[model samples]
Target: MIRKGSQILMEVLQEEGVETIFGYPGGVVIDIYDQLAKTDIRHILVRHEQGAVHAADGYARASGKVGVCLVTSGPGATNTVTGIASAYMDSIPLVVITGQVPTHLIGNDAFQEVDIVGITRPCTKHNYLVSSTAELARTVKEAFYLARSGRPGPVLVDIPKDVSNSEAEYRQLKDVKLKSYNPTYQPNIKQLRKVVELIRSAERPVVFAGGGVILSQASQELTEFARKTQIPVTTSLMGLGAFPGSDPLWLGMLGMHGTYRANMSIGACDLLVSIGVRFDDRVTGKTDVFAAQAKIVHIDIDPTSIRKNIPVAIPVVGDCKISLSQLNRLIDEIDLTDVPRKRQDWLGQIERWKGTNPLAYKQCDLIKPQFVVEKLYELTRGEAIITTEVGQNQMWAAQYYHFDRPGHFITSGGLGCMGFGLPAAIGAQVACPDKLVVDIAGDASIQMNIQEMATAVENCLPVKIVILNNNYLGMVRQWQELFYDKRYACTYMNHSPNFVKLAEAYGAVGLKATKPQEVESVLAEGLSLPQPVIMEFEVDKEENVYPMVPAGAPITEMLLA
Candidate 1:
């Protein structure tokens, strides 16, 4: 059957089970938008292109599916760069389609046309510029395939305007075979055996899990393995919910703002079994001294990431779930009667470290950001899907809110992008309408994409925005205070909008808490509301996130709070 390119695009999206897309229409994408309107797929009209991509990213993270977003050419396409980079850094699967000028005007500096494919090359996993309607369906299929496969990341497809208006016979591409790409799902048994041997012999072994554990859905296997081996576990920021936070074996998060026990354990452990982590600079404070005492066994689907940052004693290239499953089976075969006894001294040391400097903040007259996060966690019973913007708010949420399951906590861990939480919350809410979704945002970060409040209001999404209004770029200000000797830079956000009025103006409920006592009531009321809300708490402006490891310092050397 003959079909227009736009029609084929819509049909292929539906075929791929894309029920919702976050996008905006412009001159170049009018035909596509027109066809999209005729279909059953829900389109979220975001105020900005960045918001659209962030929303899609949030949706993908929450739903564990390839997120889809569309935008017009030139500036509209350029605006999505930050969000795309964020997704790329975090390895989020996303298919971003951008409209373009006709094929004839390809290199003539056409209006509403920029070389999007070229612009996004460095960040995107792959990209394409479709010149003909005949290849539209295939390109889309390949884009979706590339986006979701092998260390998932964003893939862009630029569709020329004429192609959408052109006609071609439509046929759904079922089998997509890319000769160059094939992900190893099965782990090498010898390496698994080696890991098991290490587990058996090492007196102090720590299972350091990362976002890849959650991405590969290996939380169950990880939990079981850690429990059976009696190995304490510590996670990267992105790996927050990969293991149960409330578990006795959990060592909380490990990094610059990581817990005292977690960092100390990583520094002192004899064996470090790293699963699905990139070993970013934030996690590994000094390359030379990071996990210096430990023999590292690194397992990741992306072979390039194995030895890219830190040298590994054992590099296992395979999917995280598969590798963990194999390790679990191998572990079951070993003599494990003495595992608990072997780990007793190590666990005792960790307990002492935990007791010595546990995560704590004083309850003062002024509202404390940590206290607000604690109350939110309590009120929601740690059940709410918590998304966070970058900076102090992100750190506080990570420290205070205990996540017991995967996908419960979402944040821009790698890119550390500001203005991510609110739109992400909207996307998460849309993906899971029945679940309570909250964006734990900072006052400054929240304003970055605050326009998305209208998106939530229009969609009737009951996402709650908890703004820790510290009235400054809290993270940077903290650094300036500590390192620069109180040379207060341009970090102060002297003028900001009245958040309550801002929410009300966007047709959503607005609440504020000035005193520390009002924090609980505001949270409770905001959570109880059926509509979208922005609950702002005027928090301590100069408050800082502690357990700091100065740049280039060893992870063990920390400036305590």
Candidate 2:
């Protein structure tokens, strides 16, 4: 008796130590789903295929594991596009499996079929369209390897329906080889020496760390490097948890809506050593003006990412962890002693600015944004893994929530996608069942994937959802308030379903806290429940996340609303 391709896929997954998969089943992928059911691998059925992918992304970000998402072809596969792009922009590792039409109907446009491999090629780190049962094992192995290796991003495997049911030898693919896909992780010592030379000579050297630090598991290395070099550090949104938020040298996220002092630090630096961060448009407003005075040393795992946006003085293409280790080894301990702490005045200025206009909110009768964030921080105490929906809530969480360790915060930083939180929370909870996981979302963004509460309830995953019930697309409304004269068009969500009631209907705990006085109690009650809970807070409708980085403004020119 020969094994089915679907069985082979599961066997490969087991070999890879995959514990869970997030997915939505469809007709074409039923064989694979059936195989999944027989295996010990826990499968989470998401409300939308898109949510499944995003949840997988969250799992990868939180656990540092290769996330797996499965969906059927055509619309089912296509639905995951946004989530795939989000993972791509943030460089998260994901392995996506999509069911295809029968192998025979390759280009005939068969029913319930789309060119998924082609559609996902640009967004995915790599893609495979398994046309024959013979190629199934190899494809699956290659997909996993590609997803988990170097500067990881989403990888796609499109398996045809007939191929899934086809008979083939059950030999596990052990000797998988990809000549073109090998990831070089060693740092160039010569280039690194030049970097050290630059570091020693520069008066003001700032390290602009990005998600790459976490992805490369180089957070400790980064902290050590900063401490040794006596350089102030600033981070991108995705890089928030890579360094201790409370560290004296660490300036918070740098971007539009980034901390004022952090942005100023980025602007004032003479030599900017950016690691594992792609200089996105949001972070580097006008390329010409961003870090204009800084000589950039761009270090990253992906070579293509070097100098794509910002000019680099030294481009070191290697794994950040490996590179930092090499840098640590090469630099003599005594030489670092002479590396002067040249930025005391600079540090003092930044601290003074941070002290004067710290992230603050009024203690009015209404529930404030900071209070909601602070309460969550207090309850969870930097232990719970957090996924944030885009917009003001995301910024607020980034600003107020002190991330004590790396990989504790997951958000759609690169794409800044709105409907990311709930699904991501599901993924985080699945990745680390012991940890408290929270999805902090806006009421407008929460409704986007609120249906995933069913997934949480079904899996018995206790994810606390704190909906900042602002009743509007808070981020866009802020844009309108500042730029468009407050002429809100489609930001209001008066037609949204009652979120607390919606949570109840999904067979999970439901809660509401309309005032600051009720915040602590409702949060306590929500946290006490071992099942999924949705706590809705009626925040000030017109509230805004301060320290706004106006569109296209230089990092130093932030606006406080």
Candidate 3:
């Protein structure tokens, strides 16, 4: 039977178990939208193309599935760039479909025409421009496969307007065998042995897990390995939920705003077993000096990420879950009953670091952002699926929230995209309706995509927005305060609409808390509402996130406030 390209795409999406899609229609995508309406898949029409991609990103992060988005050509396709790039950096799996101008107009610079496939080539794991209907199903299959396989990332498929209406004999290809796309899932036995030997022998050992663990759904294995080995674990920003934040052995997030203990532990460790992490510049302050005293064993599915940032003594190339499983099996073989656990001293030192200068902020008449997050965590009992806008709000959320489950904490780590939380919360809430989803946002960052409130309101998603209203761009202001001698340029945002009225105008609830005492009550009321809400907390204007490791400085060399 012949099928239209749009119909074939829908069939493939159904086969892929896609339950929902976030998209915005345009001139080139009218047929696709028509087909979309005929399918069982729920279509979320976002206010902007960027929100659609971001919503898909959040859904992917929250559900551990390949989130999908669709948009039209030219401006619609271009708007998705940042969202796609954000997903790429964090290694989130996404299949982004963009509408393109009909084939004959390809290089003619037609209306609503731009080379999106070429535009997103660098950011996407892979991309294709399908001018013919024959390749539609196969290309989509390939796009989804490439997106969720190995080191997960975004993939784009540009479908010309003409192709959507064209006829094709659709075929269901389950075994998508791409000759050049083989990913290593198993690690070398010798290298795995070396990693185990180091772990067994080292007295001072630390586990640094990254987003790879979460992407592979290996958090249970990660937790088991850490506990069995009696090693403390610290996660990158993207790896927040990879291990239980409430676990006694779990150190807070490790990076520029990492806990003092985590940074110091990494600095002093003899065996740094880095798992599923790319040693990005933010995590490894100075390349030469990062983990200088440690014998680093880097395990990852992508070989490029292994030595891309820092040199490692052992590089085990394979999937994180598979490699860790192998290491765990071998660890079970070793008779460690004779060798006593020698990590007590190291644990004690980390505890000392934790005791000396912990993540703390003073409570005053003005609302404190840290206090707000802490209260939110307390009220939610660490069960809420929390997302964040970039800046001080992101850092504070990371520091305070205790994520005990994988897929419960979603945030933009690598791209540090502002206006991420609100739309992301929409996606997360849509994915897990029964769960509480909140976006911990700063006053400045929240405004970046404040328009998303309409999406939430229209959908009646009930996603909570906890805005840390400090009347300034908190993070950039912090940098200027410390590094540029308080040359606060355009960071201050003094004049703003009353968020409560703004929420009401959008057909949602809005509440504000000016004092520390009113924060909890305001939060509880907002969170309990049956509709979307924007709760603005008037936090201290000059308060800055501390235990900050300035750029280029050693992670351990932190400036504590």
- Model 3 TM-score on a 0 to 1 scale: 0.99
- Model 2 Cα displacement at 538 (Å)? 0.6
Cα lDDT for residue 467, model 3?
Answer: 91
Q: What TM-score, computed on C-alpha atoms, does each candidate reach?
A: 0.99, 0.97, 0.99
Candidate 2, 172-283: lDDT as tens digits: 6676678877777987889999888888788877899999999989999988888777787888888888888878887777888778777777787789999999998888
Question: After superposing candidate 1, which stretches have Cα over 4 Å from the reference?
Answer: none
For candidate 3, lDDT tens digit of each residue in 1-561?
Answer: 699999999999999999999999999999999999998999888999889989999999888889999999999999999999999999999999999999999999999999998899999999999969999989999999999999999999999999998998988878688999999999999999998899888988999999999999899899988988889999998888899988989889898999999999989999999999998888989888888999999999999998888989999999999888888898899876633347768888888988999899987788888999999999999999999999999999999998888898899999999989988999998999999999999888888888888899888799999999988988999999999999999998878888889999999999999999998999899988999989999989999898899999999899999
Q: Give the TM-score of candidate 1.
A: 0.99
Candidates by TM-score, descending order: 1, 3, 2
- Give model 2's TM-score versus the native structure: 0.97
Off by over 4 Å in 3: 338-340
C-alpha RMSD of each candidate structure in angstroms: 0.7, 1.6, 1.0
Model 1 lDDT on a 0 to 1 scale: 0.94
**Which stretches of candidate 2 lie above 4 Å from their native place?**
338-341
Model 1 C-alpha RMSD to native? 0.7
